[model samples]
Target chain A: MKKLKLTIAVTGLNNTDNPGPGIPVIRGIRESQEIESRIIGLAYENLEPGIYMPLMIDKTYMIPYPSSGTDAYMERIEEINQKDPIDLIIPNLDAELYTFMKAEPRLRELGIKTFLPTMEQFEERHKANLVAYGKKYDIKVPKSSTITSHNDIRKIKNDFDYPVLVKGKFYDAYIAYNEDQVTNHYNKISAKWGLPIIIQEFVKGTEVNVVALGDGLGNTIAAVPMRKLFITDKGKAWSGITLNDEEMIRITNDLIAETKWRGGMELEMIKTNKNDYYMIEINPRIPAWVYLAVGAGQNIPEALVKLAMGEHVAPYHDYQVGKMFIRYSMDMLGDIQEFEQLSIFGEIEQSQLHYPNTQKI
Target chain B: MKLKKNIAVSENGFLFDPNSGESYSLNKTGQLIVKLISEGKSEAEIIENIMEKYDVESNALQRYLDDFIMMLQQMNLLQKEED
Candidate 1:
C-alpha cells in the first residue's frame, strides 16, 4: 500500500513537570508505517518542549490560551489554515477542547477535520457529573459530590468516611484524611482551577488507566490498559507497564459502545482488592501516557487520524501485553532566538531555522 | 553534599539510582548540579559555577540550589553525611 501523505496539527505540547500528551501523540503518529505525515505543533506556552524539537514538528504556532475565548482561538486557527490549510487537527488539551468541539462545524466548512466527542458526550462524562454518568451507563463509580461552597464540606461527613478525594473541576486532586484536609484541599484546588470542587469516595485499590479510541458509531478501534509502576509526587506516571486484562478491555468497549464515543479518551479506574473495577474519572482526550499504548502495538493516534479523515478503520484485536513505558525527561536545547521568534511572531517553521538534531540530553 | 554511591548518570541527564530502583531525567542545569555534587563540589562552588555560566544572580542561584538539594534528598539520591 502506498503511504498516505498528510499534514496534521496537534496541541497539548507542554512536557514539563506536569507533562501533556502532545509529544507522545506525535510519536504515535510518526510510528505509522502506512502514513507519512508532516506534523505541526500547536503550543499554548512558548517553552513547551515540543516547539523546540524541530525534527518532530515541521512547524509550530503559538495559539491563544483557551481562556482567550473561542472567537480569538478560532481566528488564530483560521490564519494558520490560510497559511497551511490544515487537513486535520488533533487537539490534545482538556482545556482547549470546548473551543475545538464548538468550532467543529465551521472547521469542517473550512476543510479542516477533527474527530471528537459530541458536546453532550464531553460534558456528561465530566468529573462533576461522573456519578450520574456511571449510573446511566450501568458502571460502578465511587460516590462523589460536587459542591460550590465551603459549607457543603461539612455535609460530606454524613455520607463519606474520612480520606475523601478533593478534586478540581478540570485538574488537581488531593486525598483529605479529615474535614480540615478536605477544607484545605477545597480552598487550594478551587483557587487554582475554579469552583465546584469534587469530593469523591476514596476507592482502595491499584490504579489502572486505559487509553482508547472510538469510531464515534459505537465501536472502539483500540484500547490498551496500563498500571503505573512508579508515580511522581505530582501523581504523574513516571513509569508504567501495560496489562493484559480482559476485564479492562471489556469495560472500555462497553463504555465506548454505550456512549457512541468519538476520538481518544483515557479511563482512570481503580481495581479494588476484591477485583471489582470502579470508574474514577474520564479524560475526554488522549492521555499523556499514550505512547505506552502506541508501544503496546496499538497506534491509536494514527487510527484516530484515519477516522477523522473519514477512512474506514478496522478495530485492533490483539496487542503485545507487558510493554513498559518509562518516561524520562530530557533537556531540549534551543536558541534564545527560536524562543524570541515563537513568542514575538506567534509562529515559526523548522526549515527556517538551521538547528541540529534534537538530542535526548 | 554527595550523590548516592550507586547513582548512574548519563550525559543526556538520565539518572538511575540502583538503591531505589528508580530512574529520573533532569534538565541540563539539573544534570550539571548532580554531576558537580557527585564530583565532591560544595554547594557554594556549584552555585558559583552556575552563576558564572547561566547569567543568574547569586541569591537566586543559592535559593534554587537549596531547593534542588532538598529534592535530591527527598528522592533518596543524596548520600548520608556519615556515608
Candidate 2:
C-alpha cells in the first residue's frame, strides 16, 4: 500500500526533566507504517531539545508564545506554512492549545488542518472547572473549588479538610496540609500560572492515567491506560506500564462519546481502595508519556493526523498489555554554528544526510 | 493451583505477570513456593516439602503457605481455577 505523504508541524518541543509531548508524539508518527511524515518542529524556546535531536525534526522554527495572543501566534504559523505547506499541525502543549483552537478556522483557510477540541469542549474540561465537568458528565471527581484571592484560602476549611491539593490553572500542584500552606502555595502558583487557583480534596489512591484520542464523531480512535512505576520529584512518570483496566477504558470512551472530543487528551484519575475512579484532571493535549501508547500498538499521533485529514480511522481494539516505557536523558554534542543559526535566524533546517535515502522528504 | 501461563519467574526471585504488567520480588521461601506451584504441586505436598527443608512445624508451615498463596492470588499471579 502507498503511504500517505504529509508535511506535519508539531509544537511542545521542550523535552526536559519536565518534558513535553512533542518528541514522543513525533516518534509515534515516524513509526507509522501507513504515514510518511516530514516533521517540522515549532518551538517557543531555542533550547528545546527536540530542535537539536539529530533527525527527529526536519526543520525547527521558533514561534511566539501563546500569551502573545492568537494574532501573533497565527502570524508565525502562517509564515511556517507558507514555506513548508503544513498538511496538518499537531499542537502538543497545554499553553498553546487554546491559541491553536482559536486559529482553527484561520488555519483551515490556509489549508493547514488540525484536530483539536472545540472551544466549548476545551473550556469545559479545564482544571478549574473539573468538578462541574465531572458532575455534568456523570463521572466521579474529587471535590474541588476555585479561589481567586488570599482571602479564599482561609475559607477553604469551611468546605474541605486540611491536606488538600492546591493546583494552578495550567500546572503545579502542591499538597497543602494547612491554611498557611495553602496561602503559600496560592501565592506561588498564582505568580506563575496566574489567578483562580483550584483547591481540591486530596483523595488517597493509586494514580493511573490514560492517553486517548477522540474523533469528532464520538469514536475513540485510541486509548491506553497506564500506571506509573516510578515518578520524578516533580510528579512526572519516569517509568510506566500499560494496564488492563476496563473501568479506565470505559470512562474514556464515555467521556469522548458524550463530549465528542476532537483531539488528543490525557485523563488523570485516582483509583481508590474501593476501586472507584475519580477524575482529577483533564489535559486537552497529548501527554509526555504518549509514546508508551504508541509502543503498546495504538499509534495515536498517526491516527490523529488521519483524523485531521478527514480520513476514516478505525478504532484500536487492543494493545499489548505489558508494554513499558522508561525515559532516559543523554547529552548530545552540537556545534555553536547550529545554535547560532536557530537563535539568530529563528529557523534551522537539517541537512539531507540526516534522512535515509529512501525516507528523505 | 497454577501460575499464569505467560508469567515469568527468574532464578533471582524476580516474578513478572504479563497479563497486568506488574512485577514482584520474592524471598527464597516465596520463590520456592512459587516454583513448586508452577511444578503443579498440591497444597499438602507443598507444605510437606517446605517442612522437610526448613525447621518449621507442619501446622505453622501450612498457615504460612496459605497466606503466601492468597497474596499471589490477590496480585493476579495465580491463574483462576476455571482457567
Candidate 3:
C-alpha cells in the first residue's frame, strides 16, 4: 500500500500540567499507517514542550497569538507555509478556533486545507448560547443565563439556586454556593477571560464526555465516550476509561446529523442517577484526551486529515471497550541553545540538531 | 444470582466489570461472596459457604450477604435476567 506523504501543521503545543491537544494529536498522526506525516509544531509561547520533544516535530515555529488579530496571525502562518508548505493545519485551542475559522478562506487560497466547524456551527455552540442551542436542537441542557456586569450577579438568585455554576465565555468554571462566591468568581473569571459570565443551574450527576468527529454532510466518522476516573485540581481528566454507552453515541450522531457539524468536537455531559444526560458544554475542536480515542481504536486526527483533503473515508463502527488512559508528566533535558534558537529566531528544526547535514528551515 | 459473564474478579480482590469499564477493590469477605456468585452459587449456597468459613451467626451473615448482593446489583456487576 502506498502511503500518502503530507506535511501537517498543528497548534496548542503547551504540554504543561494543564496540557493541550497538540502532542497527543501529533502522536496519533505519526502513528498512522495510511499516511506518512511530517509534523510542524505551531506554538504561541517559547516554552511549549512539544517544540523541544525529539523525533516528534519536524520543525517548530513561533506564531502570534490569535488575540493579535487575523492579519498578524495569518502573516506568520504564511511565512511558515512558505518554508514547509503545510498541506493541512489543525488549530486545537478553543480560544484560537474563531480566528482560524475566520481565516479559512485565506488558508484555502494559500493551498492549505482545514476541517473545522462553520461559523454558524461555532457560534451556536458558544457557552453563552448553549441554552438556545439546546432548545433549537431538542437536546436537554441545564438552564443558564449570560450576564455582563457584577450587578447582574444579584439577579442570579431569582433565576437559579444557591449552588449555581459560575463560568466564563471560554474557560473557568466555579461552583458558587452563595452570592458572595458568585461575585468573587465572576470578577476573577471576567478579569481573565472577559464578560459576559454565565450563571448555570448546577446539576448533580456523574460527568461523562464524548469525543467525536463528523463529516460536513452529517456523517459521524468517529465517536468515543469516556468517564473520567481521576481528575486534577484544574478539573482536567488525569485518568479516564472508555465506556459502552449507546445513548451517548445516539445523542452525538443525532446532533451531528441535525447540525451537519464539521470537524472534531467534545461533548461534556452530566448523566444523572435517573439516567438523564444533560448537555453541559460542547468544545468545538479535538480534546486533549483525543489519544484515548485513538488508543481504543479510532484515529481521529488521521481521519480528520483525510477528511480535510476530501478523501472518501468510512466511519469507524467499533472500538475496544475497557481501554483506559492515565496521564503522567516527564521532564526532558535540552541545551540552552535550543531554547535560545526558538526564542530569538522564531523557529527551530529538530532534525537540524541531530543531523547537522539536514537543511535548516 | 450470576455475576456478569465478562466480570473479572482477580485473586487479589480487584473486580473489573468490562461492560461499564469500572473496577473496584473488594475486601476478603466481599471477594469470597463474589467468587462464589461467579461460580453460579445460589443465594442460600453463598450463605452456607460464608457461615462455614466465618465465625458470624447465620442470620447476621444472611443480612451481610443481602447487602453485598445489592451493592453488586447497583454496580451492574451482576448479570440481568435478560442477559
Candidate 4:
C-alpha cells in the first residue's frame, strides 16, 4: 500500500503528424496516483518535442538510432545510466523494439528493468508472420502476403482484389485501388521503411483498436477498446472515443492468453459489415492514443512499470465507457540556445531550459 | 509555384491550410524548403541556398527537393500550373 517512487525512461518522443507513444505514455505515468516518478526521455533526434516538454521529461539524453545497431544504442543507454541509474525503461517505437528486446538481459544486469514481449512473442506478431499467428490461435485475420519484390505486388492480384492494403514493415500503409497504386505505395514505402512490404486483403468495416497490457503469464492487466471519431488524412486517429466492446475485449484476452504476451500492445482490428473482427496489425507497444486508456480509468504505463519491478498487479475489470480523446497540436516555444545545447552536446537538463509545465497543453 | 492560398506556416514547422482544414508537420529541412518555395524562390534557387547552409550534396539535395515538391503536389498544397 506504500507509494512507490521510481525513475522511468521512455523512447519514441516524436509526437507529430505521425506520432510515437512516448508523450502519452509519460502522461500516463505522471497521472499514476500510486507511483511518484521522475521521467528520463530517450530520444533519437534532438527535435523530438518531448525533449522540450520540461514537466514531462525531467532530463533527456540522445541515443543512437536503431539502424546504428543495438551495441551503440546500449552503450548510449549505459552512458545515460552512469549519470542517472534508470529503474525501468519503456521502449515505445516499433522500429526500435527489437534492439531493446535483445538488450534486455544486459539492461537487467545494470539494474534497469523492462516489461516487454519475449522475442518469440514479438516475432510471431509481426505483419509478415500474422497470418500464421492468427491461424494457430484460431483468430480470423484478413488474408495477407509479405512481398520483397515488385513482381510480388503484381502477383498479389491472384490472392487479393483491388483496394488491398499495402503496408510497410515499420510504418506507412496505403489502400491501393489498382495495381498502379499498389506499385506506387510499394516503391514509396519500401524506399523509406524497407521490405518485405505487406499486402493485406481489404476488410470492409469500421476500424477499431484496442490498447491492452498483459502480465507475461497469459493474464491481461488492462484492456480498452476505441473507435476513431476523426481520422487524419495520414490515417492517424485525430479524435477517438472509447467503446465498451465485449467482443473486442475477448479477442484481446484470447490473444494474450494464446501468445502469453507481456507488456503493452495495440490490436488494430476491423469489424466487418457482418460483425466479424479481422485482426489487421498487432503493434507490440502502447499506441500513440494510449492517453485515452489512462483517461478512461486504467493507467497502463503505471501498471506496466510495476509489472517490470516484479510487483503484483491485478487485472483491471472495469473502465468508464465513452471516454473521448481529441488530439491537438501546439507549438512548443524553444530557444535557439536550447536547440544548440541539445544538438551540440547531445544532452540537456530540465533546469537549464526554463520551460513552463503548461499542463494546459 | 507557391504555397496554397491561406496556408498558415509556423516556425516549428507545423503547416495548416485554411482551404482544406488539413494539418501537416514538417521537419526542419522541410520547413526551409517550403518557406523558400513560398518566397517565390525557383527550385534551383532553393537548392543553391540550401547547399550553402547545409552539408548535403547538390545532387542529393536536388533529388530530395524533387521528392518533397512531388509530395506537395500529392497533398494538393501546390497551385495548379497555369496551362
Q: Which candidate is the best by TM-score?
A: 3
Model 4 spans > 4 angstroms off: A356-361, B1-83
**Native contacts recovered, each model:** 0.00, 0.50, 0.56, 0.00
Candidate 3 reaches a DockQ of 0.58
What TM-score does chain B get in every candidate?
Answer: 0.95, 0.96, 0.93, 0.94
Better of 2 and 3 by lDDT: 3
Off by over 4 Å in 2: A352-361, B1-13, B17-21, B35-45, B52-55, B66-83
C-alpha lDDT (0 to 100) for residue A16 of candidate 3: 88
lDDT of 2: 0.89
Question: What DockQ, on C-alphas, does every prediction get?
Answer: 0.02, 0.46, 0.58, 0.01
Write out the backbone clash pairs for model 2. Answer: none
- Expressed as tens digits, the lDDT of each residue in A1-361 for candidate 3 is 7888999999999998888999989999989999998899999998898887766888889999899999999999999899889999999999999999999999999999999999999999998999999999999999999999977887657988779999999998999999989999999999999999999999998899999999999999999999999999999998999988889999999999999999999999998866799999999999999999999999999999999988888999898878899999887777778888888999988754543334443
* Candidate 2 CAPRI category: acceptable
Q: lDDT scores for all predictions?
A: 0.88, 0.89, 0.90, 0.88
> What value of lDDT does candidate 3 attain over all alpha carbons?
0.90
Which is the leading candidate under lDDT? Answer: 3
Minimum summed lDDT over a 10-residue window in model 2 chain A is located at: A352-361
TM-score of 3: 0.93
Determine the C-alpha RMSD for candidate 4 after optimal superposition of all C-alphas. 17.3
Candidate 4 chain A minimal-lDDT segment of 10 residues: A352-361
Cα lDDT, model 1, residue A71: 90
